[model samples]
Target chain A: MLALRLSRVAHPAVQLRRLAVAAASAGTGFLLLCTFGYALGEPEHSGAAVLRLSWCAVPLAATVYLALAVARTDPGTRPRPGLSALGLGPGRMMAVSAATTALACSLGSLGALLLFVQLRGGLRALPLDGGAARVLAAGRPLPVPATLTLLVLVPVVASVAVALSLRPRDPRRPAAGRGYGRFGAYGTAGARETFGAYGRFGARLRSGTGPQAPAAAEGARPASGAAGGRTAVAVPAGPAPGTATVSGPADALAPADGPADTDREDADGPADAEGLGSEADPHRPPAPRKPPAGLPWGVAVLAAGLAVEAYTSRAVTLSGPALSGTRTGSGPALPGGLDVGSVPVLVGWLLTTFGLALAGPGLTHLCGRLLQAVRPGPLRLLAGRALMEEAGRIGRPLGVVCAVLSGTFALLVLGRGPASALGPLTALGTLVVLGCTVGTLLTAAVEARQDRSATTAALVRIGAPGTTLRTAAGLRAAALLVLFGPLTLVVAYLSALPLAP
Target chain B: MVAPPDNDVLWARALHFTHNDGSPALSGVSLGVRQGEILAVGGPSGSGKTTLLRCLSGLVPAQRGEVWFNSTPVHTMGPLARERMRRDRFGWIDPVPALVPELNVWENTALPLMLRGTSRRRARTAAQEWLERLDVGELTRRRPHQLRQAERQRVCIARALAPAPTVLFADEPTAPLHRADRAHVLRTLTTAARSHGITVVLATHDAETAALADRTVPLLDGRCVRTVHLPPVQDTEGRAACSLSV
Candidate 1:
């Protein structure tokens, strides 16, 4: 009841996101119902009915993913200080988020039932447009038990996933030590203390205290203040080993290190980072960009996936009747299925997706490095550094989006043929996949921005022109577009090459 | 149409500001700083020192007041124009350090210079130099997460100083540092301003910090109650002599 009350008073933007989740749920529920209709209509062909039902898994997964994203971002469910006094702590909030998700999904399922019943002419006595009975298998009786079970599947799966993902962690124990949550962020805790806390999909951090900056900057220096003004300035340290005296106000105005003595890192090269290799020198120059580990695995998986797809396409025997020849084509991979079985092509696409998710952070890190490559001005350096910093958090979702786009592109390209065809179910399934991937990406981006609100406020405080920050954001977006656009196109072409007519 | 003084780099007159919630922040505050002068606005919290700084620096427009930077009337400028003015001519430091987590010390320090279109190489050289001055040059490659509170504040100081803005507004700049670190950071800030010929308007409740400034405007409940002028610190070197005026 509290959850429902909170939902009513939520910010409009939060309400919009919830509505989207419901819409996604409704779409998935409708797809499942359609599968049921097909099953009832073709009772003799249980094998084909089961295959069609199995294919609904994609939309179901998409809806669950969307629900989880929405739950993660819901501010009303975010744990707050006084909430614990009212038996509404992190654990309670987790439950609330899950319950809210279940509620939305349940509402969607009910809507889907109404729409399905109306479309199938089951509610003929009601005043509504009750048409499309033949297409929906209306004459065949839809079983109550089976329909209820199928309808409940989305809410149950989605709510459970939401609860598990938002489960509170023990304050004392580090996340990475217990077990790596999804995205392997916690798995890398032994590597860097800060990685897991800041990873985009790692954990739901407490609001306002997302991640610590660990500001303990102790360095060797002469005592300077009121006592040793001139004496302190004289020991110009290794940074300038150049004797730019810090005497009176006049001498300090000149650069400590003249142009000739600039550090090697200033140039567009990794020469300064050659020997650093993760060692904490305190005084050594900065290291080169250290992208999150998983690039190799991602590349290998992607290669294997594409290899399987290409091989299967070139030398396959169509044991099942060609989908186009006999039945309404199915299978999430080949939406308008062209004689391909579910297992082989699906495996290839799954591998490709997993590989891309694994490799996303590294590619994003590289893009950041590229932004700072040539004599970058402040905007480029800021955008590049920020991109590199957030690659872990944003990369995986970005990769998933890229994978979905590639698949959709391949499907559309393949559909431009005489043999390949897209039925309404296939299009609906495609819509769910696209919407969920894009929604997840957007949610991750919002999380990243919230995590850095302090930094943004500080930047504004230091007289940084508003346009500079805006331009930096633009630069980061452009950099990502440049890197991912061509990669997606190439991947799409290669995946489609195998099934092209 | 009352006008600002010709020699004052930053001037605010009859400044009044009320919070969005209708709580009064500043009421009829007025002050000015000469070129190369380090003027401290000394007040307890909620005394309108920060609000006065915000108005004078063109960060926020006062509800009813006049602000002038040199000859330009800042009160009439649009948000964009005020932003441009602040970027080109002013620097600010918050009580707590707030360096960009993603940027290394040098990159963070060089932000303002770069924002002004300075090349990365030149900006870096200047940033490293200022960081060296603040005794954090070795840590230029380190990100904000690696630095101590004081170190990050030092970097923030470096960033403010890198551009050598016409007016530097520091609101309790050394509040984050330890007692020992505060004096050192304050001296560094003042010395850098004097050397660069930068005008500074600092807000602090600490007498020690105010002593470093050439003059002090003490505020209470959004109004200046008294003005305290200190003898030239350069002439006295480490010794401070106060002369009070009401």
Candidate 2:
């Protein structure tokens, strides 16, 4: 009851996102009902009927995952501090989120059922196929129970998935700040303390220490604090520039290495002479350290996966005469003439998709670094930083979109290969799947934008023109497209080459 | 009431503003800021310090008073004009820094200049100059989430100063820093303002922060009660040890 009431009072944006989820659900429902119709149209081929229904599951599952992501990011659904005191903790909030999702899916399922009935000449008559009275189930009527069961499957799977995904964890392990990695919020352990301390296998370069390349292996160097017992080396948040460091009672509580080193280091830095002049007193400390950079190993992994897939498909094609009639017991292709190696190829494609998702954050970080590589104007800086910050949140969704794109292209190529290969139902199924995947990617972008409103407000307050922000947004989009567009085409071409006649 | 001086860079008369919750945030507040001077707006929490600063900076227009910037009535300017004025001629520092989480320290500091179409190299060079001044040059690559509260605020000050605006509005800019750090930040801020000929309007409840200013306007119940001018301190570096009474 609370969930229903809250849904009505929620923000309009939340309502709009929920509507998108409902629309995707409705599309899924329609596909499932058609699968059932196919079953009734050919009850004798139970295996084919089951196969068609199972194929519907892929798109159905993607839509469910998308719906869950939308729910998780919706600010209206977040548990408020007051709500916990009112006996609505994270567990109750999760239940409410699931309930809301279920309600939307159920509405869509109902719409599919109504549409199916209307198209089938009401509940009383079965439409015959082109005067062939024996083909459209002939005398076998559409089983109401079976049809209802298939219709409800989408809603059931979606709601259960939502519940499972949103269910509260132990609540003891605190959520990581900034979405990824083990770093706690500032002053605890930042990216510097984590990857830098661990001496990550790549992307580390030692400057000023010597002309030596950093060790390629993770174990080549001692941990950051191993030698000096420099535990908790707190870099004092020094007084602002141009001011003398003030020693006071508050200094006692700071960790041992606070501004004591800061004043000295401030004097040693070269830029100090120009900006601070002689006003800032001099002291000495070790040279300042640069932030850590992680290697983009994920990209290498994805490339290798695609290359292996291409090789496997070509090998299969080259020995086609020898392998003819050697089915490998993977069973017959379902209506589309897919080969026995289709399952393994599909697995390889999935592994590639995962690799792309994993590589997304690092590539995004690199994009940010490169955008500002030149003497960056403010516009480039803002955009670059935004890309780096949001890489984790949006990267996986982008990877998913790429995977969908490749899959769609490959299917289109395969469809043209065999006559009667692309049926009306199959085409409709393809459209629904591709559309939902794209919609999911767009929803993730919206979430990233919402997360940035505060930063936007701060910039505006500090005299940043709106055009600067718009330009930055445009730059980020262009950079991502420039980087990913060619890569997507290359992968699609390579993967399709071996499969095509 | 004493008339605003002819040389005042910013002047406001009988300003009034109300919050969205129907509470009055400012009432009949008037003040003037001299060119290149640090004017602190001091009051306890819930007082009109922030509201007055926002109104003076043209961030929020007052419904019932005149806000004149060098003979131009800021209250009557359109939004685009006000935005342009802010972008080109004013700077602001919020209490919590509020740096863009995505950008590292240097990028965040250089934003205002880049927004104005400054060349990337020039803006970064200028930004680095200030970052070094603020003693955070080494952490230029660290994002906001990685910095402690004090580090973030210092970066914000550098960002504000980088633009070399005519007037800088700071609303409790050092509220999150420890006493010693706050003193240092304030000292750096004032010295930089003085050297650059930039006018500063600082809002704070802390007497120490208020003491760092050349003059102070005390607010009570959304209205200015009095203005106090402090005598120049002989030892600027030792002013942190000086006792201040509100």
Candidate 3:
């Protein structure tokens, strides 16, 4: 009841975001209904029916992704200081967030049901009825139980995902090693690390399970893994950048040496210059000693994704000699005589998306560092640091956008010079995935901007000319575009070439 | 709108301004600041001190009236021109510290200078010098999130001073600091302005802060109640007994 009231009173923008979630859910639900229709249309081809059902997963994932993104950015769900007095603590807020997501998804599911019923002629006399009768198997009686099950899928899965993501945990629990590592409004982990610390590997970096690269650390390294397997480190947050005595990974060999040297420097370094000991400054937040991790992991994921796609395509192509009888359960060629939409190819595409999402934060951080690599003027330096800080919040969504675009382009390439293998279902799926991914990216950008508004106001007061800020914004956008555009095109080409007829 | 004297670095006449919602913010207030002089605009909260500073600093144009900086008609300037003017010659410090959260202390301090096309190296050196003077030199590499409110405020002050603008508009610059820190920062600011010939227009409700100025203009309900005109530089000592009565 409280969730419903909050939803009703939310800001129009917040309402709009919730509506977007509902729309995504509707699309996913529609896809599921269509999958069942395919099964009804061709009862003999159960394998094909299963294949069609699996295709719905793409839209399903997209809907859930959009729902979660919207939930994170929802102002009403966010916890405030005094709210705890009224029994709305972190745990309660998480439940509210989950409930809110479920409500939105349920609305979408209901919309999907109405639309499906109308199209299938269930509501015979309703306005705007009649279309896709043959494809929807309108001649047959729709199974009430299955239809209801498909409709509930989105809301159930979306709410569960939201609940799991927002579940309150002890900050010291480092073993979970999942989700983005970005700090949220409450400074809870992965409020955004740029859609976040780019998931599990980012968690690994945050928890200091991975070795810190010496160059990135600049000086004395921090201790690996806090007491009781926490992300917290015992070293000082501020270390002198000039005190590098050793090179390479510090955690790998001589892990003990890192703390000893760092403690001495922390005592003798900033403490003296600050005219206070480390114990004197109690307000400083613990700084991450190493640069954000996950770049290598992202690269590896991309390579593996491409390799899987390439191998799947090659195996499909090489099996051509045996033709109809011996292709080993690939569910026969499509009407175009192409082996596209096989389960292996689908798995490869998903991996590519995952890889791109994983690599995003690390790549964004690197972009920031490179911006300030040269003796950057104020513009580059400001732009660079902002990117690095926001890498976690924006990077993963950015990666997903890349994955969507590349997949769309690659599939188009495969469908060329033929009857255009993109059926209505394929087109609808593409549109939903494409729209949701872009929406997620744009939403993440908006959240990042909101987070940075105070700093922006400070810049304005500091007499930073309007043009300079715009130019910096342009530079950041252009850098990301330059980085992602080519990579997208390259991945598209590599993935499509093997699958192409 | 009589022309201000050439010697007055900042001069405002009949500066009537209204907030966007139609509330009066500044009402026909007038004041003049001579070259290298520290002028304090003293008032209680919502007495238009910040609005007055904004008008004088080219951050906002007065709804009505004329403002001149060294004989240039500021009120006549467009937004871009005013923005350019602010960037080139004016510096501002807000009541609270608001450094870019992502940038480290030195980077934040050097931001304005770098915006003016100064080399990063030169900006860093000047920023370091000002930061060291303000007792925050050691904190230069720290991000704003890691610093205390008072420490961050000092960095803001350092940032404002690093560019060495022709006029510095400090609006409750030390509000976040405790007594000891406030006194130390104000001393550094006033003494530095005196030595470097940087004209300062300080806005404060604190009597001690206003006491550092060479002249004071007190305002009430967006209208100045009284203004104490400055005597010749040779006739008065450096301190000005500026305050509000009523």
Model 2, TM vs. native: 0.74
TM-score of each: 0.78, 0.74, 0.78
lDDT of 3 at A210: 28
How many pairs of residues collide in each model? 8, 6, 12
Off by over 4 Å in 2: A123-149, A169-355, A358-363, A413-415, A419-421, B1-5, B117-142, B226-246
Question: Model 1 over residues A1-501: C-alpha lDDT tens digits?
Answer: 989999999989888888888888898899899888877876776776777788788778878887887888888999886898889989999999999999999998999999999989888677664576776788877889999999999999999999999998643323224332433344332333232232233322221122222121111011112213552444455254222222321222122212212232233123223423223332222333356888889889999989988876665434323643443444323335544443576788888888888889888988998998887778888899889988987888889889889988987875354325777888888898799888888887877776667778777777677778889888998999999899888878777766565
> How displaced is residue A236 in candidate 2, in Å?
45
Give per-residue CA lDDT, model 1, range B121-172, as digits (tens): 8999999999999899877776665556677788989999999888999999
Model 3 residue runs over 4 Å out of place are: A1-16, A40-47, A80-100, A125-128, A163-290, A321-341, A414-419, B21-24, B226-246
How does model 2 fare in lDDT? Answer: 0.71
State the lDDT of candidate 2 residue by residue for A12-107, as single tens digits. 878887887787777788778766776687667677678778878877977787787778777766877789899998889988888888888888
Best by DockQ: 3
- The window of 10 residues in a row where model 2 chain B has the poorest summed lDDT is B141-150
TM-score of chain A of each: 0.73, 0.69, 0.75
Candidate 1 Cα errors over 4 Å, as ranges = A82-88, A125-128, A140-142, A171-290, A317-335, A340-343, A415-419, B226-246
Give the docking tier of candidate 2: acceptable
